[model samples]
Target: MGVTRERAIERLAGRHPGRRGFGGSADPAEAAAFRHAMRGDHDLNPGVTPPSTALTPAAVLVPLIDHRDGMSVLLTQRTAHLTAHAGQISFPGGRVEDADPDDVAAALRETEEEVGLPRDRVSVIGRLDTYITGTGFEIAPIVGIVDPPVPISIDPFEVAEAFEVPLSFILDRRNHQRIEREVGAHNRAYFVLPYEGRNIWGATAGILVNLAEVLAD
Candidate 1:
């Protein structure tokens, strides 16, 4: 939290845009575009100081597992020893590399490297707005539908564990909570998705909110 904390704005989850079928359709193509794009709300978290600092471009894959009952979002818990975002739940991704062709490639590559989820197993459908983090990262979130029954291996160095949270649970406004705290001279406010005992907050929560808005539209 920083000087830019604002009241929590939870977008209501409703009918899915472009949904041709009824009852929780997991159509990746239908869930592509959002009515309005996200701007990495400054009031949510004023990222680095001097706003002029060079930002590292990154990408993450929002893996929607196509389960029989419904879809679930695949997320990972970073190892506590990591320098950045230690012990936090996050999407499998990292800073975009020069060898990466685009955001999609970066996301898929990072996901494979971090969680061993093959690109072939992922049906990349669309992308969400780029989210800028307080740590000076420009993150592009790529939404992909993953076919289940695939064995996922985790990178012990970076990822501590991998788990799936139901998409329905995440989209519901009743589950999203706004938490605030005083950081130095600023009052910081951010979204939190507390599932079971897991605390999903910060940029991760922000990205989920963006996804919820897109699906709700």
Candidate 2:
């Protein structure tokens, strides 16, 4: 069998030596190989960080729903009126508040505040490397396994809609696209995974690419 839900959970539960910055490969591999490969090697996001900006700290929950249909990822579409990342597909998270104890606390708290996913319902497995955004935020993506059928009440002020994407679709490297854009005087490349009608790209897509590398098979 390929990577089973149980096996994926088990792998995620293991301790990973935390890296300073975010990085991962998009190449598909068997789960056993992928797990080992993630321990010491991955590709870092290139040329996205601006030289003059100070990066703010942020955290996000990479929520994996353990459903009977199949493993899926929960995502959110931000409201169009927001000032930052408006109308974009993203995880339920934001900049870490001073009251937050750590990255895990920030992730779970934001998940609850943004999407009504109670912290108690989430089973945090581990965290991915820190992703430094061009806009100047160093984000920690926390991987969590969630129980199915839990009620979600998304905050209308921040989230326009909430939806799930099949893990199988995202785990496939072929779905990841390398896209580029010119910001001011610089051109930068980033990852994009367009699903159905939603365009999942930038930091969200980069984190998904890291997840695919961590769990690919």
Which has the greatest TM-score?
A: 2
User: What does the lDDT read for residue 160 in candidate 1?
Assistant: 99
Where model 1 places Cα greater than 4 Å from the true spot, the runs are 1-38, 45-50
Candidate 1 C-alpha lDDT tens digits along 152-204: 99999999999999888887988889888888997788899999999999888
Tens digit of per-residue lDDT, candidate 2, span 1-217? 3456776776677656454322332343432233333321113333322323344778899999988877899999999999988999999898888899888999999999999999999988888756666555667789888988966999999999999999999988899988777767866667789899788987899888888877876
Error of 2 at 185 (Å): 3.8
Which is the leading candidate under lDDT?
A: 2
Clashing pairs in 1: 1-188, 2-188, 47-134
User: Which pairs clash (backbone N, Cα, C closer than 3 Å) in model 2?
Assistant: 22-130, 29-217
RMSD after CA superposition, every candidate: 11.4, 7.4
* Least well predicted 10-residue stretch by lDDT in candidate 2: 34-43
